[model samples]
Target: MSNLPPLNNETIWDIINDKIDDAMVNQLVWDCLGYSYDNSSQQWDINNVASEWREEYPEPPNFIENRPPTVKLTRSIPPENKQLLKEELGFKGYKVGEFGPRQTRRATVANWLLSYMKQKRETSDR
Candidate 1:
């Protein structure tokens, strides 16, 4: 049996600060074994569970009006989007030290904006 505690709104907010939905967390708790959410600690605990099903990053990026990117090149972008960003727009920098998946809140929100901007550009171009 799992030692995961039943999650409440407060606990969920405390964990990810409302970055993802409750149902998703509940489903993860159900599907992933050797993991548990602590109500008091407001965090998830894993016991020797090696899986790509969990991580944490809540620092979202900032944005303003829809404006063309100024930089012509960049290396600070998380590896996944570096190529795509160069093709579509561009990025500034963020000292990630090395290339890897950045599942940060900033990355999450920036991803959404990038998708939205891409779609709009495609639609307008078409």
Candidate 2:
């Protein structure tokens, strides 16, 4: 159990979104799901409460799926310059083409490159 005070569903969600470390939030999620942390699997064991909680509160939408494929970087950086930046950032081929789940820092750079590519296609159509 976490040292933090008991949090309702909304408060748990708020804490999850805030600056707290992800590992801590993961434990909180397990608490909410009524699961006990398992050291071996590095995961929680789903208990009876989890199934009932799911009936009450459906899972939140996946962040990457919910977000736009590209951030709005095009409004600031022109497509040509962005291409040079993308090359410098070293996101090529499949990495450049897909906006998949990745480490936060790398994902931010990838999103910027994707934004530029998106704008290039948009401008080319005109």
Candidate 1 lDDT over residue span 1-126, tens digit each: 243334443333332333545344333333322345567887655543334222311211111111111111122234555444335444433457632232233333343334434455678998
For candidate 2, the per-residue lDDT at 24 reads: 48
For candidate 1, what's the RMSD? 14.9
Estimated TM-score for each candidate: 0.25, 0.28
Candidate 1: lDDT of 56? Answer: 19
Q: lDDT of candidate 1 vs native? A: 0.36
Q: Write the per-residue lDDT of candidate 2 for residues 1-126, one digit (tens) a residue.
A: 657444443333333234444344434434533556567987545543445444533432122322321132223345555554335444343435443343332333334434444565688999
**In model 1, what lDDT does residue 13 have?**
34
List runs of model 1 lying over 4 Å from the truth.
Answer: 1-83, 97-103
lDDT, candidate 1, residue 74? 24
